[model samples]
Target: MSKRWIGLVVVLWVTACSPIDPKLKQYLVEGERLYVLHCSNCHQRDGQGLRRVYPPLAGSDYLKENLPRVICSMKYGLQGEIIVNGIMYNQAMPGVPSLTELELAEIATYLYNSWGTQTGLIDARRIGPLLDSCARPRPRR
Candidate 1:
């Protein structure tokens, strides 16, 4: 094939592979709103968190590794000491138990896709199971 044809095929393939999902876009928009209203207080609008107080969500190793725990924590709250980016943070993060699975998914989608992270869409369907797993009672510190 000619060079121009080869380039055209590459471009077409790239575009086809990465089509934007409208649902994801909606999730992101709603998620931002929810984050600002519910989470941005501690995590901050930039997701930098407070200086050594609230853990920074931006480029957070904890967030990246503990997706299931994060989802659960969103509904069940998190207590005691948790480490993010090798720094230990001891804070009582209250969960918004009223947030529906869709809202949780939207917030998560926004968080994972923002601040130097690109984890794509986190579907609401996947959240239910994660929430269920952490529904049991546990001791708090």
Candidate 2:
């Protein structure tokens, strides 16, 4: 095999080996825009949630540890207690049902990786449609 061919194969392999989901990256970017507009207030310009009223999300265990619950919170709404970064917090986090699965995925993924985390990822878009995906149930008349 030629050296150029080897280079091409290496490039392909790197792209293929990348664990970060392509859509996740897109969502994280979108989530950044949305976070600035919608979430940055409480979550802070950084991922750090408010002291008592909110909670620090940058190094949040909630975003990093409890993946499913975080997904549910974003999908529906969170009312009650949450523990993040080993700190306990009880607050009401309004659901973001308005967010598309892609959007939700992006925000969560972005927040998670933004912190001290170097691995573990959330593809919440893929979690869409699951009953526990979110809380706002479809209303039936």
Compare the candidates by lDDT and give the number of the best one: 1
TM-score per model over all chains: 0.84, 0.69
RMSD of each: 4.3, 6.0
Find the candidate with the highest TM-score and give its number. 1
Cα error of candidate 2 at position 33, Å: 0.9
lDDT of 1 by residue, 1-141 (tens): 999999999999998889799898999999999999999999999999998899999999999999899998888799889989999999999989899999999999999999888899999999988888785447568
Whole-model lDDT, candidate 2?
0.72
Go through the candidates in order and give the clash count of each.
0, 8
Error of 2 at 36 (Å): 1.7
lDDT of each: 0.92, 0.72
Q: Give the least accurate 10-residue stretch of model 1, judged by summed lDDT.
A: 132-141
TM-score of model 1 (CA atoms): 0.84
Q: Which residue segments of model 1 deviate by more than 4 Å?
A: 1-18, 135-141
Clashing pairs in 1: none
